[model samples]
Target: MLIDIFHDTVCPWCRIGKKHLFDALAQRQEQEVHIRWHPFLLDNTVPAEGYEFRSFMQNRKGIKAEEIQQIFDNAQRAGEAAGVKLDFDKIRLAVNTKLSHQLIALAPANVKNDVVEAIYQAYFEDGLNIGNFDVIVAIGTAYQMDASELKSQLNDRAVSDAVIAESTFARLNGINSVPFFVINDKVKVNGSHSVEVFLETLNRAALLDIPAKI
Candidate 1:
């Protein structure tokens, strides 16, 4: 079965959802599953240099700083429940994710999942500025992506455009949120559902794939 995951690098829920999906996959060891990652920018208008994280969240949600902290606390709890750590306090910037998305797009298929996981860890755990070219280049190189080639492509305007275009296409297709999943083009799971939910969806998709008697 093939699963297409649409997510943003900065989204904590996306990381949680990814863990749930993988946990589900782990339970179904008999099934052969393929994962394809897609980019979904939560806020494309964020400047290349990014914005102060707390202020941006407050302004974007029209909430006070305390309210923003409450929201972060909620997310942190959810992340911990899923066994994924999210240190929102350490995050300083709300960055444009186009470069990070491009790095994932260019990664080899076998290691693309690792690249995505690393990017999420970098931003959410370490609070590294994933919008920075240097950070993304380091991630790509660590994943065995050619260093010079990764740098060249990430710098290319066309590659960046392609990443944005993918996000646009997703929105045009009515995917306005991050952490959405399409399972075998048949089952659709939205938001950060539980491992049981994802495993159930996988089983449903597998059943659908079975041939009918004549």
Candidate 2:
């Protein structure tokens, strides 16, 4: 089955959703699944340098102090439930993830999952700035991708364009949220649903005729 996940690195729900999907796949050990990560920019207009995390939440997202605290608290609980650690306090920046998306696009299929997980861990778990080129290069090197080659590819115009194109396609398809799952292009599951929901969707998709691609 082909599982295309539309997500952004900085999205807390995306992180949680990925963990749930992985858990679901693990339970279905006999199934063969091809997972693909699609890019979705939460804020395409963010500057290359990005914005201060708290300030952006307050100014741009209009989240007040108490509401932000509640959000973080809920996110922490969700992360714990998903077996993913989220260090919200350590995060200092909410960055533009265009370059990170490009890097994922350039990664080989076998290593793409690892790359995506690493990006989520780096940003949400460790509170690192994934928008920085150095951070992204380090991640690629850790995954055994050539540092120089990965860096080159990340800066390539074609690679960047491909990431943008994918995002545009998602927007055109009326998917304006992250952590949206399209199973075999026949079933669409939105948000951070439970593992059971994903497995059920997979089962349902298997019974239907493959839909024509959009």
Predictions in order: lDDT: 0.90, 0.88
Candidate 2: clashing pairs of residues: none
In angstroms, the error of model 2 at 125 is: 1.4
lDDT tens per residue, model 1, 87-197:
998899999998999999999989988999999999998999999989999999898888998888888999889999999999999998879998877678989899999
lDDT of 1: 0.90
Encode model 2's per-residue lDDT on 1-214: one tens digit a residue.
7889999999999999999989988978887788888999988788877888987887876879888878888998999998998888989998999988987887888999999999989998888888899999998888899988988888889988888898999999999888899888769999998889877877788788575353
Candidate 1 wrongly placed segments (more than 4 Å): 210-214
Candidate 1 minimal-lDDT segment of 10 residues: 205-214
What count of clashes does model 1 give?
0
- Highest lDDT: which candidate? 1
Name the runs in model 2 displaced over 4 angstroms: 209-214
